[model samples]
Target: MRSIVIIGGGIAGAATALAAAKAGLSPVVFEAHPASGEDIGAFLTLAPNGFAALRELGVADAVAAAAFPMTELSVLARTGEVVASRPTSDSFTLRRAELCRVLQTEAIGRGIPLHHGKRLVTVREDEDGVTAEFADGESVRGDLLVGADGLRSAVRGLLDDSVVPRYAGQRVFYGHTAKAAPSEPGRMVMVRGSSVAFGYTVSPARETYWFGRTHGDELSPAEMAAPGWRDHLVELLRDDATPAAEIVAATAEPLLVTNTWDLPAVPRWRTGRVVLVGDAAHAASPATGQGASMAVEDAIVLAKALRDTANPLEVYERLRRPRAEANVAASARMTAGATDTVPRVGSARRPADGAVERMLAWDAVLED
Candidate 1:
């Protein structure tokens, strides 16, 4: 049996471990966090492809229990008129921390060995296998190494130094409202402004998950986290004449400001026995809402590739790269269109439904 060593215990890492176990690989995971990933903060929507990947990994129901069903995406203009309504497939909205917690729990139940506080500092591969050296003076060797790390991946550096994360000139602040938002539980409401945009949804219990984004240079580390930032953010959008001001005012607390980033097609995703997955290989702006789903798909497709192919790394890259690249482009396009101007309800057409359906359509990737 060929052993697999997977780095980073976020969504991609956890799902990879489960899929590897299903392939009878019994891969071990190394997480930089102390114990769990329930602290990533913010929230996300799991698209249809994400749900399909979760179901394949055998944890869809568990994740669903912690998430709120989201079926429709209603795009509105600054004047509170609906521009378009798009139907979604089997989607759910939940806190990012909650999603990580459940993926960890399900991985643990499957007997996948996960080591916390194992921040990788160096990676070396020889003729036969690869060794991962962690910050704690511990090291492990495996026949192959998989990089499920995030955007600033140390493992990606080991693969090639060319793929740098590029900022998209936008930053977003995400938080949960202390009071229930007026948004519908089963729907997502988005209102676009000239320089900024806001989208929000309600949980099963009426709590709200909301995010606001604006185009600007990257914020300083201090300003990204300074106290009362939530209030400042509310003030910035107070004149939008939407529920954005109210939502920000009611948010419990402020989380970090995130500079939107995505990588152009990388020069390399695999080197020797080491390969990259998820954000490490392809980072997309949150505007896409397909990052997690693509990551999960990478895990499933990777596990299957390992199970059925002699050259698993090459096969995994061949099968997954095109799909990931397509989404990256789509995300850039959508984010650009959404921010072109204050979207008006009656004047413009929304993104083509066919384009969205193409992105959401993934039976080909999931078929046995």
Candidate 2:
């Protein structure tokens, strides 16, 4: 059996471990956080493409149980007028912690050992195998090394110094609120404007998960901790013509503010037996709403490639590069539309439609 070491226990890393296990490679996962699922903010949308990948990994049902399916996406002008709408065939809105719990459960059930609190400091690859050095001066060796360590990946830094995460020039506030009775299940709604935008989806349990993005260098920690954050959120939503005020008013505790950033595309994602996956390879901006989906997709495709080929690194690059590039480019374009300085008349279309479909349609399962 091939030994695989995956750094980072985020969605991407967890998914990769599960996929690798199914591919006959027992993987050890290293997570920096001591606990399995930490408070990392609110819900995320797993679109059809991402959902398909999760289904392949055999965790779709568990994830679906915790998710509310999204059926439509509405784009609104800053003044609140609906500008464009798209039909989403299959998507789900679930808390990020809930989703992580599902993935972690699935991974553990498969006998994948997870080492929490192991922060990766360095990774070295040789002809024999790859070795990962931890911050505590411990080390582990494996047949392959996968960097799913998120945007600021230590693996990425070792492989390519040129790859860097760039700020998108916008700060985002994210949180979830308990919904009042009579919540409708449907598509995610985006309220777009010249200076600000709000997007949300209602979870199955009648909780509203929403996010607001604005042009700002940073948000004060005090602003995030204010008891009246909801009120300030309502003021921001007033920029939108739609019912943003209503949604903002419905929100509750633990509002989080973070600067949005994305990594520019790297020329390659592989260095010998070492490879990068998910955000480490191609971090996309949240404007595209495909980060989680893309990461799931990466795990599926990468496992397939590695299991089927002797030169896993080459195969992994060939299969992942084009798809990751498409997503990275699409994210940049989507960010431009969402944060357009000039108000546009119509809803902005996602860039490179065929690219997303191709990723979703793959059906191969790797076996050694």
Candidate 3:
């Protein structure tokens, strides 16, 4: 099997395509969108663990250089009084679209074929190989098939129909301020209230990124797409003492909203010649800020497993499932904790260790 077909053109698929090429296989990446993530995507945090994985992939330096590394992160109340603080090191923030663009560029630079507008519709696997049929009616055959598609994956359903994505309690609203927030390198702030939580950070580009998550019912499509959504968000957090409302008011960028979702332990991750990766296999809520990091790690580990073993799917699942599942649970707890958004009372002066460090301090290398 010298050929592999990867579904999805996001982080996981891009990374996988690059790794597959490096492993001396022909890898083709298919994306459902007409163009690469040009108009969509929010900000993402890359912890040290994510950086380490990028380093192994030989793109860490470039990425770190292009991103804003956070120097300190503090957990505070709506009034902005600190309850806990963590000195963040080796953690960076970048636009999700930029990250995907960089990874896609890097993959293209390495001579990988990435096709856009190919929506996967059906997946068929026989003893000989597997084929992925796309919406355009074109089908691609390969020795191995990897479903690195996002949460709602058609390929995933083919592997196990029982695996489905569920909505978490809250939704995320993200945007960039029209005027940049203060340029503070390595500065990260998260404030929680009893019902709503908000976070704001600056990218290396000096653009201010902010997200607000509130525990509430699903919004109607009209409300979600309304031109007043930004104002609606501002009003949602008006009582909170955080800068979220200010950020929302100042943002000229298009407001983006997403209903956060996650999956429980998948009944299975692989079947026959097909296997799942990234969110397709196990998606964690963004509450822990580990979703993207986990995706990157999955790409690297999956590549290594494919290169080293005869049963690469089994090896990949064995090594990745436990950690990925644990992270999913941690994310759930973090989200639940946000439910009680009452910012803690008093000033927390001393820097405290955060689970972020322990979670970020991971060994992602695939041992020989």
What TM-score would every model get versus the actual structure? 0.90, 0.87, 0.88
Worst 10 residues of 3 by lDDT: 342-351
lDDT (10s digit) by residue, model 1, range 115-207: 888999999998899999998999999988999988889899877777789877678888876577766677788876545678888876888
Sorting all predicted structures by TM-score, with the top scorer first, yields 1, 3, 2
Q: Clash pairs of candidate 3? A: 70-186, 71-186, 193-341, 193-342, 194-341, 194-342
For candidate 2, lDDT tens digit of each residue in 109-177? 989999998988888778898899998899999988899989988888888887878876677778777
Best by lDDT: 1
Q: Mind giving the per-residue lDDT tens digits that candidate 3 earns over 25-131? A: 78999999889775355887787677766766777777876677888877767776778776766677888877888889999998899999999999888999999
Looking at model 2, residue 225 earns an lDDT score of 64
Lowest lDDT block of 10, candidate 1: 341-350
Candidates' RMSD to native: 4.4, 3.9, 4.8
Provide the lDDT at 302 for model 2.
Answer: 77
- Please estimate how well model 2 matches the true structure, expressed as its whole-model Cα lDDT: 0.75
Q: How accurate locally is residue 248 in candidate 3, as Cα lDDT from 0 to 100? A: 81
Measured with C-alpha atoms, the lDDT of residue 137 in candidate 1 is: 96
User: Would you list the C-alpha lDDT of every candidate in the order shown?
Assistant: 0.78, 0.75, 0.75
Q: For residue 260, give model 1's deviation from the true position in Å.
A: 1.0
lDDT of 1 at 333: 63
